[model samples]
Target: MSEKATRNFIDAYEETRAALPGVGGWLARRRESALDSFRETGLPHRRLEDWKYTDLRQTLEKAAFAPAPAHEGAVVLPDRRSASAFAAIDRHVLIFVNGRYRVDLSQAARLPKGVELHALADVVHEQWAKDLVERRFDDTRQAENIVDLNTALMSDGACLRIRKGVKLDKPLHLLFFSADPGASHTRNLILLENEAEATILETHVGEVASFADVVTDVAIGDGARLNHVKLQDEASDAVHLATLRARLSADAKLSSFTLTLGCGVSRSQSFVLFSGEGAEANIDGAYALRNKQHADQFCVMDHAVPACTSHTLFKGVLDGESEGVFQGKVIVRPHAQKSDGRQMTHALLLSRDAAMNAKPELEIYADDVQCAHGSTVGELSKEAIFYLRSRGIPEAEARRLLVLAFLDEALDLTPHDLARDALKLLVSEWFGEAVL
Candidate 1:
């Protein structure tokens, strides 16, 4: 909104670029060029089709951009000692702090044979960077705003490649955090080779005033199955913008679920490309917001090949002055004959001040494909509340029970155990109770 904020954005990016290791080198030079593009493009406006329902100018007012500096001393991760898909798994885990990797306090388990995980900074100068971008990049048929911004300034993230025919028994956890009171950007890539199968769990959390910017690109090979779970819980004063792009091959399956129960302002975009025929992609997500907080979940599912299938379910609950936005696009290319896509976006509003914006699109160039989308916003059914009251339950408890039931599907879909509990408590706290 103000000229100062725009300048602050540029200044913040410059500051981070200067502080990055190996300055003036090849990697830095490339990043500098990206920074220039980022400045020129800046943040997207409402004119963009995907961002029409959600506004970015609000973030301009909420943000005070600066690259978080190196956090000194030791910082402990929150303990969630519970049985989880993460608990049963034993793959290498990478952790980051203020956009920088923290080798300690991470779970770098012994991975199954023939798997390579790189902490981006350690390998950026090598040929792998070029190989990665060229072979696995996801412009998603179009460069969305978040992807462009993330590409321009991302400092550090993880890159993993699984050998052909290898099956990783444990899921890899890529944990990222930003404790500094500034903007933090992270970029990550995962490549599953032909006949390879792997699962990845990524967590994004911040306990300090900051902004989280992230981009994830995944290449799923033929016959590969990639299960991805992303968790978002940040300080209440934080801003988060993220994009996830996945390319699926013939007979490959990709299941992705993201949870959102934190941040003052947050938005997540998923761009799924069903490149190979018979590929299946599942998108399931939930968001709980209260106390004037806002969250947006947007998606684009493209069936570029014949016989691809996709399914999406997004649910949200808004309380107090909170608001939620959902925009979904399902595109079927002319060649993508017999494609099957189903999508639904819904939100429950608890207060009169609460609001939800839902947009579902179907762009079909083929006549044989089947695509359907729907959206809804409403309050709890009085009959259900009355039935609970008739059963002698208190009004408050009745409300809480119904809210919990509304969110069960999404939470149950959460692949990680601790993350599911963490999100449940976040929802509980939004109502007037302690998480304990």
Candidate 2:
């Protein structure tokens, strides 16, 4: 089954290779190389240790999705709050429909000096973009091999470069909507030079039974900072796979948060590597799932240098027959002394049929490192609910309050104030609908 699905993808690549961006260039060669690797590995399945909880090969074999066609028309955004959570934020908006950039709908004119923003095809020839695309996080090869599929078939994405000591005046929003029911692959490249700063907001919302594969590569230079927030709320029958690979230089800081509210089966993978001393990476997220939704969050934090700090926290609530998985690891290499790393995941089950699987591990090679990892899965406190109900609060309201407080810890970690508030509101609204 896996081999057949793999052949289907390979055939699609062969048919679309001519129309894909960066033909007859370095990118073209890179695409062919990635395709070869993908063909060798095929699709990940339950037999793989890293993918034991999610059988992507079986799912794709059953779905048999074709390539999403280029959509040409005005996009009708979903009616969910998450679809427009960042509408009020002052930012440059770039819209992509069916894996194709829509220049007519985008608004990113007059970007600040030293800031270069372009579509994937426009920047694929640049050295910085090539470096980011070619970079590899070998430590997590088992979990990252899926990225090869995106590298070979990626159609369009955002390319952002921030020069040294420069800061983006406002956030940059990348809005992707799946207008057709097929498949779309997107690869985003972000480069921040020394002392540079930027905030990026990403929203994925649609109501089609589609396959959305996305990869984002980020490079943060010395003394630089990046604030990233993403919201994923797609159709209940959609398959969403996203991978993020980030490298941090000396004294750099990265704060990333993700909010997952929808999708039938979704897996989000993040790999962070500290290449220099004194770097920090804070990855946190909150999710709410109901019905038959299944979501997975996989993360790895590697401390290859000394005196770095890394922390990860994820909180979620599951109801009905939904399932959630959190697999995370923090690694401190030899000679990487004084590394402070922590990882934690907590889930609240609102229904008896709901399930949660968590595996948090810490591997320390240095004697002086301080690292710990933990996970907790439990149902809502009936005693607390009764206590609130005795005080005249409605039962539904009491349950909502408890779930909100449980998830607030992770949501508070969102670096942007406005984005944090918007996420909080969305979570609350989601709970209200679920209880109804």
Candidate 3:
């Protein structure tokens, strides 16, 4: 049955291969190989240990999405505040409507001297792009295999490179809006050269019943720093799948945070490898779901080198009949002496019907390393809510305040100050709407 659903994607690829980027080049061959891999593995199902919570194969089979049609004309962005969370911030914006880059709607002019930014098609021939795309992480094969589907069908995305010792003056914002009702695959490649620094802001929002598949590959060179913040708030009927793979070199730093608010079914995966010592990686997120929305968060932190540090924390609130899942693991290799890794996940269930599943694990082989993991799932404190109500606060408002406070710990970890405030505001608005 899963193979039958996989045929749809294979057929789409065969039909669109000629029109995709890097025709008759290495990327074309890469795409063909990726398609073959996808053909063999099919979509990730619940049978897979890593995908036990979210059955992507079953979900995609039910949706039966075809290729998203090419979207032209002006795109009216979603009217909700979550759709434009970063509008007030000063940054370079790139907009993609229906999975195609809209140069007319993007504002990436006058980038820094050493910064290189182009559409996925424009840089497919570059060695750096190829290296980022072809690089593999061995620890999370099952979780990362789904990336082959994105590689085979990826239509367009942002390709960014920051040269050594360069610092981007402002953030680079990638906005993906699904204006049509179908499936769209996107791939983003980002490379930060040694000692370079940059920040990335990503937002995905749409109302169409669509399938949005996205893959991002990042390489942070020695002493480089990359900060990433992402927000996902698609339609209630939309299905979203996103994967991020990153490698940190010696003394490099990566801080990534995500806030999930919408989508009927969504799965987000992150794989980080510490290839060099003294590097640091911080992955954290907060999510709020209502209705029948279901979200799954999976992460793998590979401390392959010595003297590195990694941390992971995820906190979320579930209401209505919504469900949330978190699976995270931290690995410290035998030679990774002095490595420090920690992971924690906590959730608040606002309704009896709401459900949460969390699994946090640590694999440490280094005798000199410190590693810990924990998870907690519970409902809001009745005493606290009653105390607020007795103070003349409306029950709805009281619940909102407590939820905000509960999520603040994770939201506070957002690397960027403005983006942090923006996420907090969006989460607050989402809770208000959920209650109403």
Candidate 4:
């Protein structure tokens, strides 16, 4: 069943892709091929194994396809609790909206002494850009539609790097805004050189029934470290599908925090591939769903080296017929002995209609490795509720508080304290004071 709306959008997109400047016949040909794939595949349906539980085609068919009109130059972050530590973090920041870079709101002139940030559009034509892409993103073709399409049509995104052995005092912020009812697709490729270390915050926000499909590819060189926080709080009518892929070299370390809040149908997929010995990765997140909404979070950790470790803990709270999906996979290759990987997912259903679906998977080829995964779907504990009510709290309030407490372990894993608090307050406001 093809939706005429999506077809109409594809038509408009064809025209827009044709009219874009500076791209040559080869690039345009690639865009046409990608658009053709999109036309055939549309959005992945539930029948597809990877998309078995997500019927994204239904939501995407209802979206508008025209790129959003340009807006005035001012940075507007979604409101958070006043005391968010992120507000004071002195970080290099890039801002984008509706698939275009926001120059005014973005920081360009003054970054750390050795740091360099360039918009992808500005550098794609340069010889260095080709060299960088060849070396850093050679594995991009292995990804899905949103990723390949972003590569084919992407004109602007961020390219960031810190010099070897540099430790910066501030964080790097990548902020995305949908702002209108048009579908937005963008790509970002980031790299960290040897011995460099940094923290980055990536966030997306918007209103209206729209779509934001994005991909961020990161490559960490030897001895480098990256702390990434992904915050997704788009409009309830938005379909937000994104991938954050990271590849680490020897002795590299990566820590990631993913927040699944806002949006009607949103999913964040993370692929962390540890390619070097002694590399480390940590994944953590918290999500809350309400009002018939749905949020899907999935991650894969590939252990391809010896003496590596990865840890994952994701928790969710569902209410009002909202649903949560969590799928985690840990793969340890045969020779990758001494690998320690652990995964856990827990969900709390606040209503009979609210539901959770979780699958924790472990595929181990090395018998000497220690890898384990566990998931549980359960209702609020009556004993905990009774204990809270005994202290004079209302029954509903007690349940809400208990659920919030269960989610704290995931949120506390973030290095940014303020973002965690802001998310807590957001859940409170959305679910009422009972949840705080």
Candidate 5:
């Protein structure tokens, strides 16, 4: 079954390669190479260490989704709060419905000077864009072959480039809505030059059982800074796989956080590399799940240069028969002295049937480096719940408060104040509907 799905994907690529963007150029050759890599390793399964918890091959075989159609005409955003979670925030917006950019739904008219924003197709011919797309970090390429599938079939995405010494006055929001029952592959590129600064917000919401495969590659120049926040609340029957790859230069900084609230099966992977001295990165996230939902978070931080710092924290709650997994690793190279990295994952089980799997590792070759990793999985303290109940608070209310407290520690890591509060409210609402 997995091989058939792989064959179908390869066939789709063959049929659409000529029509895809940047045909007859460097991108065309890149896509063909990506296809070759993907065909070699169909999908990541439990046999691979990085994919031990999430069997993507089996999951894709079960869904068996075809490529999504290019949706035309007007789109009615779903009335659910998840669809408009960031509507109140004033910012430049770009909308993608069913994987195609919707100009009518977007408002990116007056971008600041030195900020160049274009659709992926428009910038594929640019040298900088090609450099970003072609750059490779680790030799364990086959472990993340799903990214190759995205490269071969990516339809559309946003490209943001900030020149040196310029700062985006407002945040840029990318909202993706999956209205149909098919697969959509998207790739976003962000490049920040020296001393440039920007904040980006990403929201994903869908209405049907769809496959949302997205990859966001970011490059931060020396002394540049980027703050990114992502919110994922897709349909319960949807399959979501998102990968974020970021490279930081000397004195550069990156702060990224993700909040997951929905989807039946979802995996979020983040890879951060410190290529220059004195760089810093903070990666954090929180998630809440119920029913039979499954969510996995994978993060790897590489300290290849000296005097770099990286910190990661992920917290989640599982209810009903749900499951949660967190796999994180931090590596410090031999000559990368003064490299400081810390990683921790914590999960709260709200039901006896719920399960949590956590693996945190540290690989250090530098004697002067400070690296530590720890994971904790436990249920709500019954004593604390009883104490709250004894105070006359209702049982549900007590549980809600306790759960919120458990997740707040992680939410506090979000860099944006407004987005942080918005995510907290969404988590509260999710608990209200979850009935405990």
Candidate 6:
């Protein structure tokens, strides 16, 4: 039998290729090559070692989503708190509705002298953006087999580039709202030159059953620093798939964090490569899921040079028969001496039917490296809940307190102070709704 979903995507690409960016240039050729790769592998399924727990091929076949249309009329933000969780933060904002940039709804002004920001179509021809898009990672292909489809169909996204020794005045926020049902593909590119520093925030929200596919490519130069924070809260019937790839040069630093609270089926993938010595990458995330939702978080960090450091931590809460998964690996190359890497994943189940799957692995080829990985899946401590209740708190309040405390450890890892508080508030509200 033929793969119906895969064939649909192939046909969609042929139908929309003319309207996409880079009509006859390098990106057009890149898209053709990417589509060829997608045809060869189809979609990732249980047969793939990395996708043993999440069968994307099966799920997409069932959804059978078509291309989403551009939301033209007044785009009203979703009523949920997740849609405006970071509105109070002082930052430059860019809004995209139904995968198309909405400049009228965005507020970006007075960028630093060396900073550049544009939509995907505006900067598609730039050499820097092209380099970031075409860069390849290590020999890990199975995990990102679905990325080929995104490359071929990605319609619009944010493009940010910071010059050498420059620092952004405030955080740049990218907000994506799915107003109507259907599917959309978005690609984001970020480039930081030597000694440059910037912070970025990403938010994904939807109101109806939709399919969201996104890819972000990052390149950090020597002595540069980049901090990224992402919030995902789509409709309960939505499907979200996102992949992030980052390359760090000598003495560069990257701190990325994500919080997932919505969606019926979602997967977040990250691939980080340490290309020069003395680089550091910290990848961490926390999630709260309920209903029959399924969320998967996968990360792989490659230490290709000497004296690099990397850390990974993921914690989540599952309830109401929901399921959570965390799969991570840290690889230290043979010549990558003095590399220090650590990975840990922890989960708390709030109900009997809730399930958690965790796999943290370390592959060290250097003799002088220090690497460790650990995972823990447990329930809220009954004793702790009892103690809270004994302090005059109601049973519902007690449970909420304990859940917040359990997730606090991971939330503290968020690099931004104000954003951290915003996330905490949203998670607390989510818990309150769960109790009702």
Clashing pairs in 3: none
lDDT by residue for model 6 over 196-270, one digit each (tens)? 999999999997889999999999999999999999999999999999999999999999999999999999999
Where is the poorest 10-residue window by lDDT in model 5? 139-148
- Global lDDT scores for all candidate models: 0.75, 0.93, 0.93, 0.74, 0.90, 0.91
TM-scores, each model vs. reference: 0.90, 0.99, 0.99, 0.89, 0.98, 0.98
Report the number of clashing residue pairs per model.
Answer: 0, 0, 0, 0, 0, 0
Off by over 4 Å in 2: none
Per-residue lDDT of model 1, residues 196-270, tens digit only: 988788777777788888877788889988887777777788888887878899999888888787788888888
Write candidate 3's Cα lDDT for 1-436 as tens digits. Answer: 4776899999999889888998999999988898888888888888888889898888888899999999988789888997889999999999998898999999999998999999999998899999988887899689555888888899999999999999999999999999999999999999999999999999999999999999999999999999999999999999999999999999999999999998999999999999999999999999999999999999999999999999999999999999999999999998999999999999999889999989899888889988899999998888999999999999989988999999999999999999999999888877777772
For model 4, residues 1-436, the per-residue Cα lDDT tens digits are 3556447557656656644522674445556666676666565677766666677777666664566555565645556432132455566667787767888777656676777778766655654345444333332333455555554556567777787888756777887777667766676777788999888888777766777778777888899988888777777778888888888889999999887777889888888888889899998898878878899887889888888999999998887889999988898988999999999999988788988889889989898888889998888788888988999999877876777778878888886676667666665665564333
lDDT of 6: 0.91
Clashing pairs in 4: none
List where candidate 5 sits over 4 angstroms from the true fold: 139-143
lDDT of 2 by residue, 1-436 (tens): 3788899899999989999999999999999999999999999988877788988898888898899999997788888788799999999999999878999999999999999999999998899999998888868788555888999999999999999999999999999999999999999999999999999999999999999999999999999999999999999999999999999999999999999999999999999999989999998998899999999999999999999999999999999999999999999999899999999999999998999999999888999988988999998788999999999999989999999999999999999999999999988888888872
TM-score of 5: 0.98
Model 2 score (lDDT):
0.93
Q: Which prediction has more favorable TM-score, 4 or 5? A: 5
For candidate 1, the 10 contiguous residues with the lowest summed lDDT are 79-88
Mark the regions of model 4 whose C-alpha exceeds 4 Å error after superposition: 1-13, 18-22, 25-42, 73-85, 126-143, 428-436
Give per-residue lDDT, candidate 3, residue 12: 95
| CA deviation > 4 Å runs, candidate 6 | none
